[model samples]
Target chain A: MRFVLVAGTTETAHIEGISAAGADPALMAHTPSADLEIVEYGQPVQAPVMPVSPTGCPTPAVITRAVHELTEFEILALDAGLVRPTSAPTVALEAMPGRDIRHPRPVDSAADTFEAARQLGRSLPDDELVIGETIPGGTTTALGVLTALGERAVVSSSLPENPLALKREVVDEALAASNLSAGETADEPVKTVRHVGDPVLAAVAGMTIGATTTDTSVTLAGGTQLVAAAALARHAGVDTALSVATTSFIADDETVRMNELANDLSLDVTVTDPGFHHRNHSAMNPYIAGEAKEGVGMGGALALADRAGISMADVREQVVAVYDRLVVDESL
Target chain B: MRFVLVAGTTETAHIEGISAAGADPALMAHTPSADLEIVEYGQPVQAPVMPVSPTGCPTPAVITRAVHELTEFEILALDAGLVRPTSAPTVALEAMPGRDIRHPRPVDSAADTFEAARQLGRSLPDDELVIGETIPGGTTTALGVLTALGERAVVSSSLPENPLALKREVVDEALAASNLSAGETADEPVKTVRHVGDPVLAAVAGMTIGATTTDTSVTLAGGTQLVAAAALARHAGVDTALSVATTSFIADDETVRMNELANDLSLDVTVTDPGFHHRNHSAMNPYIAGEAKEGVGMGGALALADRAGISMADVREQVVAVYDRLVVDESL
Candidate 1:
């Protein structure tokens, strides 16, 4: 089998740790055992080209480009700046009441990205198609989207040590600001997108629904992505597994609230926490720990596992190998 | 934090998948979030280096080299192997007595590689001591070593599907060829390394023991490697945590024979299966299934989890991710 990995942050994609983590499992499994082919999404999205934000979130324009470039991949598609609502709600608003909610330059709205993803899905072979996503700052946005759509969610930062309070505070504030409530069932909640969600969530939701109808498995590889995808799945009435590749930090109590929100949505969710098994001893550094807590595309990883029928142990080992390499690189 | 993986073969090291299959709570508690780290160990020792074997096992040296060369951060140390006896045996000589048994090539020998590992470990900072191994056909050698030293082991495989019969057959053959009975204890098994086990096993044992004494958590990234390291820990009388990473395939075994072996030596054993909660959906190929049936280094992954204090759910998720990627690659 051949895999063409869609790169989201092109510049960071080549970073030794990131590439190693993404590629190791495929390489190991296919090298001597099966005929495996791998191709990375060639487009490069440079990091640090735009100043690093104190919030640690990438700019929206960067995200749009990331998703736009995903057109190159035959299977995988990615957008750095898209997020989804955590739950379903019935409401429609023409625009936010006070927030300017300006569309950043080189604007590619969630709908645009969604269409692109749908087009990518349309181009695939009729066999079981596997679709995954990668987005940074996704979990926080996932929390915003979920709350905006009326699903109570607990957001946890990816810090090495638990940062439950901070995550919860952010989630609560976002929901309050949006005047959103959890446990609401609506025919549609289009307004939530403008108030709390980002473009990635909408794109993934559209892609997932489109792919599932064709009997494909859509895996959201990060915790945040899973939450966004799950909400979209729920909203769209799509029946497919929603897997979340997380760490112990995310799977544990501090993050359980987020999982509970997922459960409430009746989303077929699976969490893959590589940290619980393969501890990245080197990642214990406070700095790296902080980055980990930010939550990468782990939800999509879990979704991939669900589609693949793989056991958790295998996933943990692979993620750990990648994580260990990442930590080592950071130390260097 | 960075790991350089080297794959070795130790067929006798495998144990039944019953523990994971049963989801034994005790075992679950110790499971690592991730388990295996795939990389090349020196060269193919058992199967011929062909594109495809009659048994469908592709014994490709290129695969091994690919794993080794793909490494970007950590230096690849290919040569040393490690395995633990199910029982405390007096000599390593009585462990593996098959026609294929011989000293691992000097470049691939345990003693030489271990010396290098010792130097490497000594040079690195506390966090940079991440180590992994790849020993094909290792479980058999592990059982041979353990049994020669008087340990009772029900060696099994970690094939995607169960291969209990094939695993049993291999175990029976290795035992039949040995001079030691199943229950005889060897007071000094390490000294007899020349008689029973191969070179890589001895070196890994040495490296792990050496790493532990240095005040850092040394993870045995493979099952056989962990088992072998655990045995060394017992011999050395240390109480440090050695992390063992494995997949759900290993955890599926209900017998807990591998755990029993680790416990017998009074070595702290932690088992992690990354497969339990993975999202991958694919059938296990027979050849790879056969290898899994012969058991992979699940014990090692478990040990790593125990030492790391990781949870089962987390480990399962990570393993699932890796397994999904592997399966996806296969289909491609």
Candidate 2:
């Protein structure tokens, strides 16, 4: 039941103008401290409610942290294209800082990054590993990577109401900007990632390939972002053992159609139910309403916690305590 | 039987002078590319020999690389306190580069690096791990650490003749400069490293503490440097499951009482013989001559490779081939 959590980021999240993700701009602003919190506390508690979406919703990193408390999950922060240094020890994939995905080539170093990631993959044992990510504007880039990989996916967002129009607008602009067409990825998977995907996805693809080659089971954590990464790994022909693990929040979101995305790529999916509605934390209420559903690996963390024998109630109570510590009595 | 090799360097290695080690000055300069060689050829073949010492002798890294090709053990490069960027994926402990041991403090970031290493240890599954390092002037620091921990043991060298006088001179200067006394490690293990040890040794100590915390069997690879780290970890009471693994070239050398050093620490030692003399590679003749004694992950890599059933002949041929490719036929 033990696992390693590879956390990473992409600058493209901040470039897409805040609304692309459900995490609150305030929380997003505090994203720099996420690794610090993880290093200091068993869970992330960077004051003012951790990394919540714009709607006061929490980031999945909190869930990942809480799961660590329950299961002592091994966590490794992977610096794929981050804007800052992580407070925690990090396995640097040494990716070039991501370019604006809006320009049709968000990650020019995709090939080099992939090579490094694949080499990294070649080194890790195939023990079951769950790789997760936290990129603010990741979904838009996911849409880009997916689109380039010949799939038109309906991506979910952090905003509960699902900023579909805004996402669609960006998608349109990104498509027009990149001049990429659907069904054109048969021979250009790496190129597609270079043009539209972020560094995290590319590293994930490379890690998945590397992990699977040694018979290690892999679970891609997060929602649409991982769904897209799964497709790339599969396209690279090393993803038969890959599974996408997310939360019911993302699974039930009509906007993301997460299940459909998984099916599109013939991947297995695991959706953990945190039962936030049964909890006492109002900070979590937005989740039931579908706002800021999933991002920072909450889905995978919850699933892993459950696998380690933690109950949904335990997860809810612990998460509420974290919310209270981080959100309540802001003056403290 | 698969494991990850966390390799990195510390500026301390270079500070001890080119004569402090047996690695050729030319080959030693390319240490940063050793991981690249591991990634490309499954052993180190860094365009030039990765780590020959001042005496024109081969190092344990060369042997480690040859062993890796036969064993195919999983590897991960961990950057403890390196002077340059490694040309491969690395788990950066992000330690401050080392200062000269001639000053009171050699590594200022020992505690911080140790904390990071412990976190790294917490994150890797208690699965078996072989942690190795390559700090150019590490022996002097090892002397500092060992001395600080109350052990006035003799230190080994990359030089066949063992530059004991020069090393003792430096150690005496470092101890006097730091105003540190023997057995002062109750509150100064980390500081001892800071004042006289290198980041690689500190990281090795930290990583050993962290790795052993999770019940994972750990093998500290190399000669005196690792011996010092083992002492610090033991002094801290976190090295119960730790073992020191090294090469016979280092062990058989009359210069380094490596066995007695291990015995003093009450730690188990496993010395793997690569049987290089039976082979035709003149490049390896230096090892039998007792030059470039050990560094990189060679000691541990050799042990693990043997465990994986690789014959000494297999290791020799592979090493010779690498030497031929990277050293002998320079035109090609």
Residue A196 lDDT, candidate 2, scale 0-100: 77
For TM-score, the strongest prediction is 2
lDDT digits (tens) for residues B1-332 of candidate 2: 32344444444455445244425454454564564444334444223334445544544555666676566554556677655544344557748777767777667788898888777665553377777776666677787778777885578876667777777777777778888766676456788788878777777788788777877778887778788888888877773757888888778877778778888788788998877778756667877777766777677877777777777788788787666655643344
Candidate 1 is graded, for docking, as incorrect
Residues A21-121 of candidate 1: C-alpha lDDT, one tens digit per residue: 12232221111101000111111111102211233322112212222223221222233231121001001111111121221111124455455555444
DockQ of each: 0.01, 0.10
**Which residues of candidate 2, in runs, are more than 4 Å off?**
A1-12, A15-49, A321-332, B1-78, B83-136, B142-163, B169-332
Q: In candidate 2, how many Å is residue A192 off?
A: 1.3
lDDT per residue (tens digit) for residues B1-332 in model 1: 43434333332332334222112323221111111212212222111121222233322222222322322222333323323111000111111212233322212243444454444443333453445444444455555566556665544433344344554455445445544444343654453343445555565565566566666566565454356545644554556666555444444455436566656765443444433223332222432343333222333433344445655454444444444443354355
- Return the TM-score for chain B, candidate 2: 0.89
